[model samples]
Target: MNLESLVNLAGEAAVLATGGLLIGMAFGGFAQVSKFCLRSAVIEFSKGLLGSKVAVWLLTFSAAVVSTQAVIGFGSLDVTGARQLAARGSLSGSLIGGVMFGAGMILARGCASRLLVLSATGNLRALLSGLVLTIVAQASLRGALSPAREMLSELWTVQGGPSRNLLSLVDGVPQFGLWLGVAWLACALWLARRARIGYLIEASAVGVGLAVGAGWLFTYSVSQVSFAPVQVKSISFTGPSADTLMGLINSPSLTLGFDTGLVPGVFAGSLLAALITREWKVQGFHDGPSMWRYLIGAALMGFGGMLAGGCAVGAGVTGGAIFALTAWMALAAMWIGAVITHLVVDGAVAGSVLAEPLVDQSSGR
Candidate 1:
């Protein structure tokens, strides 16, 4: 059927969006407050100062696992919608793209999600990065190099892999899948304990991560029911940034689409918490040189993510957490990309603790 026939289920989309918004706000707020930054986490780990960033990382990761699965168990796991684990999502693209994305993150001093929260927190560099990221993402989606990306996907596609949604495997034989997920949960908990995050930070990390996972499950379970059975999926920033425009301009073109859309949720969620905490702060730009640096870093990140197919949060948290091989490829690629960016820009691959508000070292996975 056509697009209009699908989105006609306005209420379902609204629920999905609402769930996503809540997740976004909580994630943003947690990120803003606890500094849940992948860039900082990695940088610090690389630099040998892995004290602070560890707690939040494990917390967020655990939350993603538990909450996402809960949504799945109820048959709400929208394997089709999230756009992350889809068959069309290429392995080579995820690997190369992630490395590039990660390297850019290392250079730009944060991951895509971190960039968003950092921009909100008055980091002019991050603000510029966000702007550049948006533009480059737009171009990559349907711009000059899109044909290249498409061709690349056609060329290096991996065989024998489950060429459908990544989450499908987990849903198929849930007994084994649940065990794996349990192992994941155990590992996250173990990491938290080992990190000595105490109670508050660990709790916060789990809270934020699980909330996001629930958003995924909500979309998969809630939105897919209609005149026709549609596949559900999770969230990712890249395509959605491209898709956000599609939603507005092409609303008439869609009968139904994935409902969870996490990026929008994070933005809205973060803002709500920020406002509630009286953090309705509006950040501004710095001087020209700083702007240039931010733009350059963001451009690299955009291209990297374009190649990788998702940002750190997309691959690292959402996909990687779900145990998608492609997601891990992207995450590794992202880290590598960030490191490459750092090598080219600052001439140092790793360094000391954070000197600026948004410039902490990288955290652990």
Candidate 2:
């Protein structure tokens, strides 16, 4: 539908919400089928095993980078005003928070987006952990934990604009971002081929990337058409999840926007996919220790995501696709943290007969 038609039909808020819902559904479904999880990829890589998990993650990341850069190269999108690049960002927060988030995901057995997806697939452990994550996220964003987040964010700040944009650093290179994406895509393809990944899985991984690109395009389009100011944003779960949860709890009337619609849309889409594939089965924590581990992980993710300004998918993929400096830093920090945590935590209990499984059964490992 044209922009004018959409605005006239349900107003700006509705239009944004609708766009988020559609994009979120695509991401959720593709992610479910592809078994895309950053934690898994990190684990596989840390163990020196370049397996299907790593291939799927590489494909998804490369796809997002390629598609988003392709649009920018074609002059269809301008992300200069996006929060990741436009606003003052924190280097300290990105590093510290990224590490925390990585370690947290290792313990939780999922990232923010993965928890939401698993919750939809009848995983009670995920559902509970997701709830804790949301509540803690809300607390971190505006409640008691906000001060700590703010303090970390202020430790080292970079002014927005060209400084935050990676492409801007390499001035005069025509479509440098696009070429970078292409290189990554080539690597992803090579890895996928070596893993002998099926076409359907590969396509689904690409779909996840396309969904991220669509989010950028859709929001930008809405901003152009709407009379009011609209933030041009793509997929990210941290702030959105907190906003959604708070809207449900405190607001008399929920604010209608991209974030308000994203969480639920992802949940619904994942649920649909699970049911269709007969993957929907109730699963819960197998023991008290496992339950504590999940809750602790959820808490860490919530606070860390808020402090870092994004979660695994939020900062790592969505922001990284745009070549935001802090996003890349955060992504690197996450890898370091995940690898270290796996080696220390998982390795500590590796030889124990009573140690919990390395991969959660419900994660489709």
Candidate 3:
């Protein structure tokens, strides 16, 4: 490329990176402030306490679905363009990987996104889990386990293009999905208000949804106008963690994109929050057994994320927002996996389902 072309490329990449960073930071801050974790949601739900956390989770998703559909309706994006929402959706990957991801999150005491935030807050145990999760996820994506990944994906994958989303199934009537989301959001809001949910919880949940929606909008905008080959995507920690690591180690040959910017941005945002809150402190494992458990948890999460084609955030939240079939499948499978782990491993998983409003993280990990 010529000098002008190189400069233009750099400028475009910068813009895209900036958007990704802002999105990541928003999510990081929201998650940190809210102590948001799918594992926590499952645990609390299992305990029969349909608390504010669950309200936050459902509202966040409903908001995302509504916002995402708005973007698509405005002709700014297409759900089918998303790799995860592509024509060929893998059922096996969703089922097996989701199950593993759920169990792993419980074992590690947090999901992939939760660990990332915790790691930034100087939790050495989370740091270790994050590292192992990254390595194992990378292996599953492109390393030793890639063959198995391919085999499973191919074996159970089905034609999902035509029915990838509600809009597509309804032949471009995105209003249907939008209305559906609105109805869900209305119910969520009613429940949240009835429970007297706190402002922080509601704001954080909505903000996270906006962040996810903004990611799709920004990436779509960049891909639409940028001359360079840019991949359109939203947030997902598993692949992005690997992509970021590769970009860091091989900057001369590697081109940093949305993923590279996002992963570090999340860490930076969480780090900033930790610093401001005076929560940064070393927290390594207390014993070898605990360390081994974390290691195993990381491996399961990594393999499962790759097999499922995305982690909790990737599939459950991002893909689910767009109404992807695989995402819903994975979300259910992951939930089942968590329930099983809680029943068998966590011993009865019994607790009262309190009707508390979603509020602060007074009782969180």
Candidate 1 per-residue lDDT, tens place, 1-365, comes to: 43244446455555456556666667776666556777666655566554557547755765686667655666646454445554556777877677767666765567778776665554556656776786787777788867876766565665333553455555557645445556766776776677776776676667667666755665555544544454454556666655665566657643233433456556665555555666555554433444555565677677667777677777777776556667777777666665555555555323222212232422210
Quote each prediction's TM-score.
Answer: 0.78, 0.97, 0.89
Error of 2 at 214 (Å): 0.4
Per-model root-mean-square deviation over C-alphas: 5.5, 1.6, 4.9
Winner on TM-score (2 vs 3):
2
Q: How does candidate 2 fare on TM-score?
A: 0.97
What is residue 151's positional error in candidate 1, in angstroms?
3.4
- Which stretches in model 2 have alpha-carbon errors above 4 Å? 351-355, 359-362
Pick by lDDT: 1 or 3, better one: 3
Candidate 3, residues 1-365, lDDT tens digits: the string is 64345436677677777777888998888877766678877987898877776777777888888898888777878766788766578888889889998888777777888889998887877888888998898888889989988887777776767565545667756378778888988887876777677887787777777788888888877776677766778989888887777666758654657776788788888888777777777676655655665677788899999888788888888888888888888899899998787666566432312111222121222
Count of steric clashes across candidates, in order: 54, 0, 4
lDDT per residue (tens digit) for residues 134-233 in model 2: 8998898889999999999999999999999999878899889888888988888888989998998899988998899899988998888889999999
Name the weakest run of 10 consecutive residues (lDDT summed) in model 1: 356-365
Query: What TM-score does candidate 3 get on C-alpha atoms?
Result: 0.89
Candidate 3 residue spans exceeding 4 A from truth: 1-10, 172-174, 194-197, 250-254, 348-365
